[model samples]
Target: MSRSTTATVARTQPKRAVLAAMLLLPALAFGLWNRPVDAQEAPVEIPAPATTLNETSASATAVFAGGCFWGVQGVFQHVAGVTKAVSGYAGGAADTATYDQSSNGSTGHAESIQVTYDPSVVSYGDLLQIYFSVAHNPTQLNYQGPDHGTQYRSTIFPLNDEQTGYAKAYIAQLDETGLFDGPIVTTVEPQKTFYAAEQYHQDFLTLNPTYPYIVVNDLPKVAALKQLFPDAYRDEPVLVGTL
Candidate 1:
């Protein structure tokens, strides 16, 4: 099934039995149906931003949209300094942020995550590094993996002028390095209100690790985070439930 069709079905059923059946399908068959034409299966190694923000506050918030929020949130949840990583919608009005509306790809929303962290422990630049490197492929224009829509576009919503400057600089730095085969399509959007997704979507990767979608697409992201950033990776994910 196509990603959109699969998403519609998943939402309607929301049952483990249905998901388990998907898991039983052969991996080859699953790949044929769901994998991206040019998926970034492996994480890239990118340099830290030469310019980073200096924040006096203990807590800071950063929002990013890069493909599905499940994998992006999962990746950050494993990072040491992230206090909370929430799956949500951004780049649209609050009323349009609901999953059902956002799924249509015309809600002006992108599936996104709000990451709350302690800047002292993990710099915004560090999170940006992980975002560009392991969370999702930035070069993909408007989709990630089998998912295709404006809702799956890669974007960064900066909270302030400092973040805007850093994000733009980092994007330029990554582009100049020629690390990615194509130019990074990730965009820096004006800050938008973020609405947390429904309860079922929170900590989805942690709660449903064996769900076919998570198994096939998201698990690799968490693995890459652990392998690529050992110092930043935590053994226990800081789950949304705990927040």
Candidate 2:
């Protein structure tokens, strides 16, 4: 009951409170240190493999039947980008479709030229330009000039997806640009079996230069290609045409 005894009791109470606070500090520090880490592990970064562009010599091939294979083949041969041109038959039934059979309009095959060109040199669009301007008449449906039948129809047989997309887009662009007076009847289909014509048909104009057909039909194509694409034509083209 005395003042000194009461003061002593209060000071002892303060020491007890400090000791309790020190005891709780370890639990609080441990809880802060052990806060939950992300349950998921850090994702690993895997390096991606390098992609490559195909650069084969025969990178891209397309078949086109403009009018006459002779003229078509000749025109493409002069083009800078064209690697080789083979007169052939396409869009036909799977059988031995030859010039004789195709011309008769019974084989359902077209008198086409298989053009192997380097995409790095010239684009497919440029090839189409040569096709429409000097290669053959796109306005003509199922026929080119005197030739009348599916054998002379205008078509671009695309070899790959890129070619397919480019073919469609080019046709659509030509249609929109009003390049042709009538509908562009050129068919863009997936490439099918291409049968190279017999050896005799390979370079008919170049061989038979003085032939009447070459003078009238084939020579004009050559001249037009030269005039249209002077850069593509060679001054000393093959002198195989000796009539």
Candidate 3:
């Protein structure tokens, strides 16, 4: 080839390379940007298995903490699809935990519950709706009403990636829309060992209808839930007469 031709070809190579990169850049950016939201999107990480329950399986489990377990558990128990809502502790150390021990906050536990439900009847998202609007106040940073401590803090202990995704999305929606004046501080974390609250605490509302706290603070939530989601509420408790 002539020297002039060789020089022209060499100069053209740089422009060709730039053009190729430009062509590929959008495709690369598209993949990177739309990359499936990893499990949960934010600080919360949900394990993969929890959200995808086997279809052959009849039920799924969800854990949440909203102030005292009594109010949280009672609300879920009445929800039509929820087969069980056992108040307990989660997202803390794996030590053997109990109500008394967790109350101190040394155990790193929160008063929580393991809710077993038929996803066919209610969705994880629906359960969360009740959780946010009626289960407990997400705005309360570290306390719910009179209860004060990390134990009583609002939290979602997602069992799997889907739950994690849903939770983070919901919080993001609530935050973006300005649902709360302050930031939504509800913790979205992985599930941990769940220790059931003492039997007496299981159905505190039923067991102690006259308890001042139940009458004053907890019952209102139950009423609001029934009013809000009438179809989901069941008047009869699973434990029956005594909760």
> Compared with the true structure, what per-residue lDDT tens digits does model 3 show for residues 1-243?
742233223222333343334446767534543444221111121122224323334798889998878778878877888888886778676564765466666667888978888888877777877887777878787687656777778889988886778788777777776545467789897756676765556666666654444554567677777777778788976552233
What is candidate 2's CA lDDT for residue 215? 49
Ordered from best to worst lDDT, the candidate numbers read: 1, 3, 2
Measured by TM-score, how close is model 1 to the native structure?
0.88
**lDDT per residue as tens, model 2, 167-186:** 67766766776645577799
lDDT of each residue in 42-102, candidate 1, tens digit only: 6898898987688879999999999888899999999998999999999999888887788
lDDT of 1 at 73: 93
Q: All predictions: root-mean-square deviation over Cα?
A: 4.6, 37.3, 24.6
| Models ranked on TM-score | 1, 3, 2
N/CA/C clash count, model 2:
1
Clashing pairs in 1: none
Measured against the true structure, the TM-scores of the candidates, in listed sequence, are: 0.88, 0.70, 0.73
For lDDT, the strongest prediction is 1
Which candidate leads in TM-score? 1
Count backbone clashes in candidate 3: 1
